[model samples]
Target: MGLAVSGGPDSLALLLLAHAAMPGNIAVLSIDHGLRLEANNEVALVEGICLQLGVPFTGVRVDVGPGNVQAKARDARYAALARWAQEDGVGAIATAHHADDQAETLLMRLARGSGMAGLAGVRSWSSLPNSDIPLIRPLLWARKGELEALVGDAGILAVNDPSNSNRAFDRVRVRDHLAKHDWLDAEALASSAGHLAEGWRALEWYAELDWAEMVAPDPDAAVQPALQYCVNVPRTIQIETVCRIIAELGGRVTRSEAGRAADRLWRGNNASIGGVLAMAGVEKVAKVGVEMRVWRFSPEPPRNAH
Candidate 1:
């Protein structure tokens, strides 16, 4: 198993506890996002800790481009971790996302008017996007203050990132706001996230069932890559089935787009989304009426007009 240690209180505590529990079987991975000069020194300090503990360590440097630094940095960090785990033949990557972090995440997504899946927040155990490598958050049920106390008890000095307290980020703002309210329960919020995750899993299961029954590839369509769906199901099932078909065709569509497409198709109108054109039509054969909605997906041709 590999542990992603950022030298923070939560992660450092996790590193110490995991090392003690699984001696000679744990490895450490630290990522230097190259965002600040102190990042290098932080990685060095973590590497030194690993060396002192006699654990194998590797440091990876990543470039984070502009626009939403937090989100981009997260994506880059996970991608790097996944690649390293694959190279090292590690099946799971564990990190120190605690109950407080999960509560903050749930609040942040709620502020953004997120759906159930988004409101599920940081999962205790899940896979990275587009990869099968598992991500485990063993300390997810632990509180941040408890972890900090554990670090102090162990006499371990950990590095704190300044950005964590910077109010410029939404997460930091949410964290600060939560700190001011003593009535709010982090454990309750985290438990709510877990319940929402279970609900999301049930929805995915039903979506798969609908996909199998109502959607299929249209091999005989005029377009090269297309999907055919029977619109005789409920509107929710229609949108879910359309989303699955679009993903299978290498096209992307959001929930809003799918809903809009369903509405337009019901009105006998054609809709285009993410390079996929959805057209509704009906054909009669052998005195029987057949209703079919064909969604044709193709890479958009280059356009000179801006």
Candidate 2:
């Protein structure tokens, strides 16, 4: 296992626990996103701690692209970590995402009217972004305060990232609000997120079944393959099924995008989303002896060159 230590209280506590539990079997990996001047110092702190613990440490710098600094930094960090893990033949990577983080994520997504998956928040086990390497959060059930206490007891000084206190970030604002309110139970919220994650898994399973039963190939000899599906399932299932089809057609679509496309198709209108074109039509079902509504999803055609 590889531990992603960021020199923060949570991650440093994670490093301490993982080392205590696994000893020589665990390695430490850190990524400098190049967004903060303090990142190098943080990585150095982690490296120094790793040296004292007789654990191997590797740190790398990554470039974050434009647009959504936090999101891009996260993407770059995971990609770099995945690459490092692969090179080191590490089977899995563990990060310190505690219950407080999960609670904040749930609240953030809820404010945006997110669907089941988003409301589920950060999963305990997932894949690295665009990578098949296993990403595990061992601290998901732990609270942030507990981790900080653990680090404090261990006599380890953790890095305090100034950005964490910046209210300009939505997460920081949500964290501040949670901190100010004693009524809000972050642990309970995290548990709710876990339950939602299970529900989301069940929904995905049902969506797979719906896709197997209701969806079929268009049978048209076009450059891009198309999928046709009859509306036989419930609306939520229908949305999931359409999202799956859009993904299969090489279009990355969110649930909201799928829902909007489904709505347009229900109104006998064509909709385009994430490079996939959805068209609604009616077909005669000889077996049912009635006209059934059907939707076809295909890759959008290329625009004519200017």
Give all candidates' CA lDDT scores: 0.83, 0.90
Backbone clashes for every candidate come to 0, 0
* lDDT of candidate 2 over 160-242, digit per residue (tens): 99889998899999999999998888999999999999999998899888888778888882646988888767778888988
Q: What TM-score does candidate 2 reach? A: 0.92
User: Per-residue error at 257 for model 2, in Å?
Assistant: 1.9
lDDT of 1 by residue, 268-292 (tens): 7877767777777754322235535
Give TM per candidate.
0.89, 0.92
lDDT value for model 2: 0.90
User: How big is the positional error of residue 140 in model 1, measured in Å on the Cα after superposition?
Assistant: 1.7
Looking at candidate 2, what is the lDDT of residue 113?
A: 90
Output the worst ten-in-a-row residue range by lDDT, candidate 1: 283-292
TM-score, cand. 1 = 0.89
